[model samples]
Target: MSIPRDTRATVTEFLDRLAAGDPDRVAELFAEPVDWQLSWPDEGHPAIPWIRPRSTRAEVADHFRALAEHHVPERNATTVSAIVVEGGNAVLLGRIGQTARATGRSYTAMFALHLTVENGLITRYHIYEDSLSVAAALTAAPTG
Candidate 1:
């Protein structure tokens, strides 16, 4: 479905601010009591120390902080490949490029994000990415 101009603009700004790596500004685009989910299994959580489901806006900022602590993000500017809007929800197609801080190994993968935006504020965020690829990079964090 075609994305509305307003919603597209909102998501674009959200993505832009996210890529800028300012957690506080990124959190501002989210609604209070934000719902955040990472598409990783329970058993796989330990390997990826930074990724976990978050329920609050403060938790969301912490999540990004944790990510920065573990990985040096190379995708300072992430490209939004596609945007699909359904009602108040939008799916964003993109990728993240990063280097594991401990191992200095590059980890890059395509990603899909499901976002629920109401009144231009994101209320729900569910991200799906290749776990095996992500975990591999995460594993080397400790050894390297």
Candidate 2:
């Protein structure tokens, strides 16, 4: 599929910011009021507190911060295997590995993220990931 240069650049920047693990920088690439969506159930909210809904850029930063607070920094990992961009929309296929600090349990999950970039800012952020594995890692007892 032919992808727009500008769209690809924006997506690249987003990925770069994410890889840097800087929430503020990541949030800066997003629009003021972003449409954030995640694949999480209502009952699982407490188990993974960072997996919450967000709209504003500040909230976006806060979301990352919350995730950082709950997960071990050294154990956090993200690998983007593929990215497809068309116009201002992009989809990222990747795997994420993280260890829950509270329970000392780890989980790895595949994730598909859809982002809509308009005027150089991401407006829509929707992510579908293996929530069950993440919840299990966060809430389950440590195996070791």
Worst 10 contiguous positions by lDDT, candidate 2: 1-10
Give the clashing pairs for model 2: none
RMSD to truth, every model: 4.4, 4.0
- Per-residue lDDT tens digits for candidate 1, residues 37-64, read 7888754478577676677778788878
lDDT of each: 0.76, 0.85
Which model scores highest in TM-score?
2
Per-candidate total of colliding backbone pairs: 0, 0
Considering every candidate listed, which one attains the maximal lDDT? 2
Give the alpha carbon lDDT tens digit for every residue of 7-116 in model 2: 78889987777778899888888887899889986444787777777899899999888888888999877789999988889999999999999899988999999999
The stretch of ten residues in a row with the least summed lDDT in candidate 1 is 1-10
Stretches of model 2 off by over 4 angstroms after superposition: 1-5, 42-44
Error of 2 at 126 (Å): 0.4
